[model samples]
Target: MKIGRNEKCWCNSGKKFKHCHYGRESEQAITKGELIGQSKNIRSRKCCYVPKALQHECDRRIVNAHTVSKSGSLIEIADSTNHVYGLKINLANIFKNKGKLVPEKIGVNQASTFKGFCSKHDKQLFSCIEDHPFNATEEQCLALMFRSVAKELYAKEGSLLSSEVIKSGDKGKQLADQLSIQKFAADNQLGIKAALRELSDFKDQLDGQLLGNFTNNLSHLIFESSRSMPVAVSSIVSPVSDFNGTIIQDLGDLNVVAEQIVFNSFSSDGKGYVVFSWLTKSAIILGFVNTLIAIDKAGIFGALIRLFFGLAENSFISPEWWDGLPDAQKKKIESLIMSGVNPFKFDPKGLLIDDGVNFSGWNIDNIRKINF
Candidate 1:
């Protein structure tokens, strides 16, 4: 029979279930190499990303949420089913090692996810955002995706801080300030919630008109072997910050808010640049720039920015230059441009390596291989 956390332990230890075997089941599951499914912790708290109007009802039934959707497939630099790339960076070790890189065998999984949202909001609100990336093309689609991810990241940070506040032994002004920060984060998330819901409705209207074209564009971008594509996409197994130490410091100055997604668009010397970055434990960065910039040059810049400034700024071949070209011709140019960049040149310490039988010329796949 099942037992409640507050009830006596089934083992008859004369202690509460929580203090006795409440969490042991999870521990055993982990030891046995099984996924724990989801968190068993439930509390009487409002859905963190729910709209203000629904706040009252949200508190009545809350569920553990996944920060990143589990459904989306991880974007791979090179697609080979038989070959798996192993990342030897341990994120938890970075903090314990006093900000030093400690390499360990951390298998990279495309399906990695974290828990933090209510079931109702997850299905109704965040699912659209999660699904957008696969077909994202226009700026509006990207904005909606970024905003939704940012809200989830900030909410997770606030939840962590709140837990710390509760666990702290001290009770004083400092504790009050911590609580205030947590509340501020929660408030910020609500604004994102309202914006995302509005965007979702707007996106629904555009879907009928834009989705077909967007899907066509995406297919051309992903499947065509041409080098002229104006964008680059790459995924890393560890936290983005662990790969770049300076980001931890640079991000601190952007704002007091936790884990902000940085999106920037600018033009320099007759070239356009677009950068979308989500600063999470695992990050997928999408970059679009003028095609004039060499892929290797752009890769170098991407690595340095992540290393020194936690950003990427590079010139791109102008879209106006190719505006009238046939769609077929344009796709070829885009493919060539994408093929030129070495996406994996930035790991200064050589932490990322490819172990699969087929090593596609993807820059990330060629970086120094570590045999941990």
Candidate 2:
């Protein structure tokens, strides 16, 4: 199908084709500066919270709240300078690193932070886990997962809104190039839309629990480590397979809502913990969680490190710990982190499977569950 000369542009610029990409198709399209500026501007937009009711009590100014608390979690991994190496994967960094994901030193205050909450709401809603010690109680688990959900939703919304600017990359191309670019953009937008729907539903449930000081329709798995690993993370991932290489959900089918699980790692009160949280009805994720549980205690740390590197970019690592790793181990970890960023190197089935790496330096001392 061909767009008419006077029809709305395919790039969603809301301008007629003749006035937008008509004659300029043969010329260089949007510059890198414009694209970068527009993208940054889009992500910079802030909101109080997802629920409308809470907006009434929101502080006038939005703050960059840390998904992993600075005082409780990041401090455990920070070095003498109060800094950790966080995985930085953005347009600017990618270009600088030649399409590789590299770990860069980040101050504790800035690591794992997102502009998703107001000052008052950030402190008020997370007081249970932030102000108090982590005991894996219902409230603490709920708060941990809620913060991850909020940050993930904020990121997805930003990506969805960046479609127009992203599609403008096709401006300098021929008709064939334009069609190809627009088609890919269309498919990617569909996936993002589906994710937004699922995340919005989950966030609503969390809102109710946080507001009422109760938990319902939520399930979580807590893995306790008596020793703290020199790493901390907060992220939401939709795993397509379990550790045994069994398929869990077909992520290719955009019509079927993908199963998502919130995974966070942090250390508090002389112990490190890994927590998995999801809706009770998410049978797909429940099976995935069970697979995680079935892993022998000896291999749990390796499996988790793989998952964190393969699926999460919001993770941070201690500089001393990372620099101390052998060259082979560093390359292995870097490869896993790049799989999520570089599509050509991605292998979905290998994400959680045991590959005999046996990553060390952490142990699971106990396991606990709530309403699973």
- Each model's TM-score, in the order given? 0.33, 0.94
Tell me how many clashing residue pairs each candidate has. Answer: 21, 0
lDDT of 2 by residue, 55-160 (tens): 8888788998889989878988899999999976556666678877888999998788888999998888888988898988887888898899999898899889
**TM-score leader:** 2
lDDT for each residue of candidate 1 in 209-261, tens digit (9 for 90 to 100):
23343331111112222122222222211123433222332221323232323
For candidate 2, what is the total of clashing residue pairs?
0
**What RMSD does each model have against the real structure?**
16.9, 2.0
What stretches of model 1 exceed 4 Å from their correct place? 1-47, 53-64, 75-115, 129-133, 137-372
The window of 10 residues in a row where model 1 has the poorest summed lDDT is 31-40
Worst 10 residues of 2 by lDDT: 87-96
